[model samples]
Target chain A: MHYFDCCDFTIASEIAWPVSFPASREPEVEIRYRNLPTDLGEGGERGFRFHAKPNELLICVDGVARYLIRGGKEIWIEPFPHADEDSIVAFLQSSVLGVLLLQRRFLVLNGGVFNVDGEGIALVGCSRAGKSTLAAAFQRIGASLFSDELCAIKQDSSGRMMAWPVLPALSLWENTLIQQGGDVTKLRPIRPSIRKYLVPTHAKSLSPVPLTQVVELKDYHGDLLWKTVDVKEAITLVLGNTYRHRFLIGMALKDAHFLQSTALIQQSRFYIAQRHLTVTSEDAFFHFVRTNLAL
Target chain B: MKSIVWLASYPKSGNTWLRIFLENLFFATDEPCDINNLRSSFMSCSLDLFDHECGWDVSLLSHDEIDRLRPEIYTYIDSQWENVKYFKTHCAYSFTGSGEAFFPDEATKAAIYLIRNPLDVCISYAHHRGYSDYDRIIAEMADAASCLCSDTDQPFWQARQKILSWSLNVESWLSVEGFPVLFLRYEDMKNNPYEAFSRVAAHLGVNKSELEIRQAIKNSSFEELQKQESLNSFKEKPSRSKKFFRSGQNGMGYAMLSRSQVASIIANHGQIMAQFGYL
Candidate 1:
């Protein structure tokens, strides 16, 4: 048995995870290896890979595995015959973990969070919006990465938004690795036949940090246009970028998600950072964020 | 329950022009529709849509894996979408390794397949890709394995589009049996905008008057599109390409290509070319 600390939850699992930090506390969640039913039966919303209800969700990857997460407390995994271990674990860390957090009613965005000085700054966007790349650049420039690919957020007693730290490594494409001046030939791909690699950062925070700013990276061809968004726009932006937002309606958490977004925007300043597609250097990105966020 | 109408084409065809025309026809106004804010049609290969509907980060999935789930994703979208949604795609009509159609019949209303001459596609596609080599472009159009955004080295905002060769792409759409497909030649669109666009409006069941159709045609004219592109740069313009709306002329293929390049394209796609009046 292995225990890991992730997103403020101590999880006990049958499979050892390389990404999360080892936990020494009583577990709040349990991951077990068992056979999952092919069908969840009627009366729930269905997606390509998942079936969601108010308290349960099932994620099925044809050749990888079927994962059933219930009530944010237990995860049942059924690995397919001859499934690649790395691919199964990758899904477990990404989609499985993300759904569990949402089941716990936490506000999760599909992006990365990095600690700048003592505060957490979230860089959120859809895929290829340079979230992981910018987070990697921030790490190189002395910021501590809290998580990448999924940013789970919560609130303290004083109503301040806090970012719960997850995995310490960043999943970067081969081109990004090359641009970051790292040797690609030495690192193993995240999964066999995939070009993305998991590169551990020099600095990472295990504890939660105050999330002060949320920046949405947009891909624009022309000059970089950075602007602060009002609360209404921020709510829309945050909801649009929410991780697995389609699951909200199916899980009957639409109102909760909205309340979370409203609460988050109240605490964190939101901005849209349109990065010029032509700007390729890491230093340029680091300088841009530093100048815009005044970090 | 079919709700999706696919604006399917090979690269550099009149897909964008048709989309702009439809936008003007449906949402008529004093000014032309913003090329950036195209509310009429959404991209079928959008990374965000896949992530939202599939409930997984597409970056973590392989191209084949994503392709396998595409039909289910479309079904999910169709279930929730209220109106008849138009989706633009460059992917050729094909099936996944699991023997399922990429565009499922249950979710697909119809497909408006746009075909340009391989000879001309060679010219426009070279520009769109920022390549000066006509020989390389012709070779890719002939190779059946050609695909768009299939590189694994970097992530893309759009999903991997399996375009195949120019001839194969056109043939694939023309041969689909499950759904009705309306094939519109790019040459016909240029030479006879009235008849071609009228056919498009009728096929889409848009109840626009004759005057509205004419006005939409005028509003989305090649010149107007070029002017708009100049005034406000098109978001769809490739990072490498200078402009999205290049010369929309008919025979740039013959004008630019060397004798050997023209012969190579003709040799590869002569059958489809002759059938479509390109011969």
Candidate 2:
């Protein structure tokens, strides 16, 4: 079994996952690659399948993969022939692990995380809101790159919750890389037939840190519009900004997500960051972020 | 499961106007439906919807790759939802690289194609995209492979819509196999609003009295839409256009287009033009 340390879990899997975290501890979960249940336990929905009881949830991605997360301890994976290593890795990172984390009742959010002066800052928004772009800007200006997309907030023994950094790679679109004045020729595309690149972090950490801010992104419009959201709206926004929020709904984990949301709202500050996009800009939006946010 | 009803159209057709009327018929709120928060999602071009449905992020795939998997995504979403849905699309009926239909027949029950006069569509298309080149717009309409929003600069809010030529777009959906389709001209809707809309209301299986339908028509009138846009804002309006709900007229295309420009559209789409009474 190939072992890897992922978000504090020592996971042993038949398929070699690309997590760079050192595999030091004993394996807590075993990821098996085999045929999953075809019936999917019946009585649920289709499209994106998620069937759940109290301690277990089954998720299937038709003809691609099926994951059985049991008791939040082990995730049994059924991989199909058509799915490649990249696809399998994507499924694991994109939804599978996030589902497992949510099933384990962790406060997981869909945001890009960065460490600025030992404080974790997250850029959260819909896809193309430029979360990864903004997050990369923070690191380029010399902040420690903590995570790019998935972030897990776990409560330490002292009953205080902190944001746990994820993988050390940022998935970014070509235009974003170009606008930032980085050479695209050096970067590697995240997947086959995709122009988006996977830019690795130079300095990173897996240790947990206290969250400083959560800025939700809106599409590029006129100029930078900043809005400070109150706790109530922040709760809703955080819930909305969570990793595969709809999939969480499918997993029957709404109650857990709600509780986690309330806790997150109380724990961290939330802001809305708005900007605009074009073939080329006057470097106005990029300037506004660095100057205003003190990046 | 009840298959989705597709509100299909080429860009600049009266699809949004019809959707507004339908929205009023179904929801009937005291105020107009917020343009930004429309309850219905699009059929063909929503990038985020595809990303969410496929689980694998589509932003990570080539437009071609995403196009290949389009049928699966649509079928999956269609089968998942128990309630009937109305989806909006502009894609002409075409097969993918895999030789499978991009949109699945099993996922849809009916389609309503809103075809506007190509001459008028040119004016609106120019206004919508802020393109001032009239000849270019005409050429695009006649070009079979013409499409919109295919740039890879930064992921577009919508997917690429290969609408084909104006004539072919109208023909493709009208003769598309496996599902039923109804074609309504932009002029017909403008000339006989009540009759045209009533036919639409009846076709959608909307169980409403004549009075209710009339009220819906009044509520979603062109003037009402323009008024609502002025009062609040239309989120779908392009940054280029001064306002989205501008001059919903039948012969405005003729008033705006030069004699040669009109001749160009008519000559190019002559057969399809005669079929639709545009000649």
Candidate 3:
């Protein structure tokens, strides 16, 4: 058995988590390996038919595994057909964990959250927005590492949005890795089926850091246009990048996400980082972002 | 029980132009539709839409697994929306490895399959992809598994589109065993746009008058699209292309290609070329 201090939850699991945990903390969610139910019943709605729900949330990855998160305390998993092990671990570390946090009504954002000189800077965007590339480039410039893919945001005692980091690595593309002089043979692929590597970083900010700014990256072909969004739009924008906001709707935590976004925007500045849509060099884009974000 | 219109086409085949026209036909007053902000319909292979509907990051799953789960998204959309939803797809009529249809047959009510001459497609596609090889473009057009926006080495913003050959793609939609489809030819649109667009309007169930169609046609002219692109670069334009609205003429094939190049394209797609008056 392995344990992880994930966000605020003490997660005890059958699989090892990338994040660390002290055994002193009491467990909140216990993930165990078992043959999960084939169906969670017929009356509930489908989140694209890979799921069904009544009292518990059942998620199926056909020919791979099934996951049943029961009452927000236990995760039952069933591995079927394929047992690559690498992919299953990735699932636990990423989207599956994201869904659990969201089901728990905690805000999980799909972006890069890292500590930039003690102030947390998050680069949020859809895929191809270069969020990870931005984060990796920022880290290369001696910025403190945090989380690259998923991060949890919630309220703290002082009424500020605190970003609790995730895995201490970033998934970087092969082209970007080549530009950075990274050896593809050395790094581990996030999955065997993909070329994206799990490039480990230096020390990551393990505790809750105050999220100072949220920059949404967009691939604009013209030029770099950075502008601060209004508060109303900021709320919608942040929620839009909130690690599968559709899951929030599916789990009926839309209100929770709205409240979380409101709290997050209140504490952090939101900027749309519109950049050119070309195969940019590391130094060129790095200089542009560093100058604009002023990191 | 659902109204889903498909703006289906092979790449560089005036799909964007048709979309802009539709946008103007729906919501233009004194200005042309914003080229920078013209997502009238979400694409069939949109990463955001799939991620949103599945409530998970599809990048984590293999492409095959993602394909298996795609039909479910349409089912959800059909259940949720009570009105018309147009989705653009380049994927030909295909099935998943698990034998499920890639596009949900139950959800889609109609499709608009756009056909352009292969020779024009070669020039436009070469510019769009920045690859100068006419032979490769031809081979890709004839292949059964030609697709785009599927680079796995980088952060994939676009979804993987599994479009087959030019002729196969056309056949896939037009011969779906009684599925309703409206076929629009690029030559027809270029020569007699009024007739072409009016047919489109009729198929989409839009009751635009002759004047409205004329105004929309004028509004979304090739020059206007190029002008808009020059002012504020289009988000959809590939970085390699100098402009999105390149000379969208029927004879562009002749101007851009040599006689041999034209011969190569016709030889590869002779049947479909003749069928669509390209020969």
Candidate 4:
């Protein structure tokens, strides 16, 4: 089995994953390649090709594979015939990983996290909100990469909310790679057909760090604006940016998710940063973040 | 279980106008409802809604993959939503790669299709897109594979909608056998507001007094809409566009297009336009 350290947990997977950190402890989670049950019996929420129960979720992406995540401990994947390794691995890294984190009760954000100084500052937003772009920029200026795409956070025994490190790769579009002064043709695409290239980071944080700020990046045509969120709004922002938050209700973790968000908000700062799409420069964004956040 | 009534139309048609009218009709406020804050209708292709309802990141999925899941997402929303919901869409009535209807009958109560003359639509569409490329717009209108928000290079907040061509869009909605479709013309709505909107009220079973209809028509008039737009810019307006409610006239568009431009539209959509009295 291939062993890796992800989300502060030792993951022993039968399928090879592209994470950077090696497992330092015994396995807390096991990923096996097995045939998942076709049905979940009854009383579960369903999407087009998936079903979700309180502690189990069966996701079937046509032509890719079927993944059954159960009880936060194990993930069973059944790949479709003729499916490429990249496609299967892409789902495993994203949606399957996200479901597993939710089952483990971590406050996961669908964005990237980076270590600024010693604190974990998360940049959360919807898809294409420039989270990876900003994280890449932060890393260029000496910030250490903690996570990309999915950021998992949990309260440690010391009552400090910590951002758990995930895979040490950032998936960036072609334009973003060019803008970041990287050669796109040399980088491999995340999936064979997709234009997004997976750029591996050299400076990766393996251990969890104390979580401090969660900034929601917004793409707008107007001037750059920053809105300071109150604790109540901060809770909403955290929940809204939570990775696949719609699954919380289906998985019967709405109350638990809300509580986790409340606790996270109590310890961390939250802000909504609107970046002008056309006029604002990347340097301007970095300066704004550095100035307003005092990083 | 079906609670959604689609306000389906092509771009720059009377879809927004009908939405405004419905907003006024339902609330019956002293003053007109805010153009930016219309609660009557929601867009069908909102990416955030898709992401929330489908319990996944849509950006990770291919456009065809997203299309396959849209029916199920809409059904989920229909099951959860209590009241009758009106969703505005610029998508033509079409099926996914898996042969599933994009606007599934199981989740749809009915539909209101607002069709306009292609000649006028071309002019308004150019303005709405903040461009004056009439020839390009004309060509796009005749291309069967035309769509809205189809850009793949950049991230957009809305999902892609395949609207097809002018004739195909009209034909597709007209051929729907699963649910009732109240096909209204933009010209008729502008000319006979009472008769046109009364049909709208009847189709959706929104019973209103005669005075209510009159007041709603007055509140949703082109002048009132223009005035409201001038006061506070409409949120749906493209940033490059100067105004959203620009000259809600009929024949003015026909007069503006070149002789060849009008002939091209007639050649492309002659049959459909004639059927709708637009010719």
Would you estimate the TM-scores of all the predictions? Answer: 0.94, 0.89, 0.91, 0.90
Write one digit per residue (lDDT tens) for candidate 4, span B135-203.
998999999999887765455668889999989999999999999999999999999999999999999
Segments of candidate 2 deviating more than 4 angstroms: A1-4, A12-19, A30-32, A43-46, A49-79, A219-224, A249-252, A274-295, B40-43, B54-56, B230-232, B239-242, B258-260
Query: By TM-score, how accurate is candidate 2?
Result: 0.89
The lDDT per prediction is 0.86, 0.74, 0.77, 0.84
Q: List, residue by residue over B1-279, the lDDT tens digit for candidate 1.
A: 898999999999999999999899889986788777789899998888877666777777788877877888888788888999999999889888978888999998888999998888888988988899988888899889888878889977777899999999999998899889999999999999899999888888788888899899998999999988888677788767777899988899999999988998999999999999889
Clashing pairs in 2: A220-A275, A220-A276, A221-A275, A221-A276
Clashing pairs in 4: none
In terms of docking quality, how is candidate 3 classified? medium
* Interface DockQ of each model: 0.59, 0.40, 0.52, 0.26
- Give interface RMSD, every candidate, in order: 2.1, 4.0, 2.4, 3.5
User: Over the stretch B139-203, how does candidate 2's per-residue lDDT look in tens digits?
Assistant: 98899998877877565777777889988888888778788788888788888878888888777
Docking class of 1: medium
Pairs in clash, predicted candidate 1: none
Encode model 3's per-residue lDDT on A89-180: one tens digit a residue: 77767777777777666677778788866788888887667778879888877887677777677788888888876666778888889878
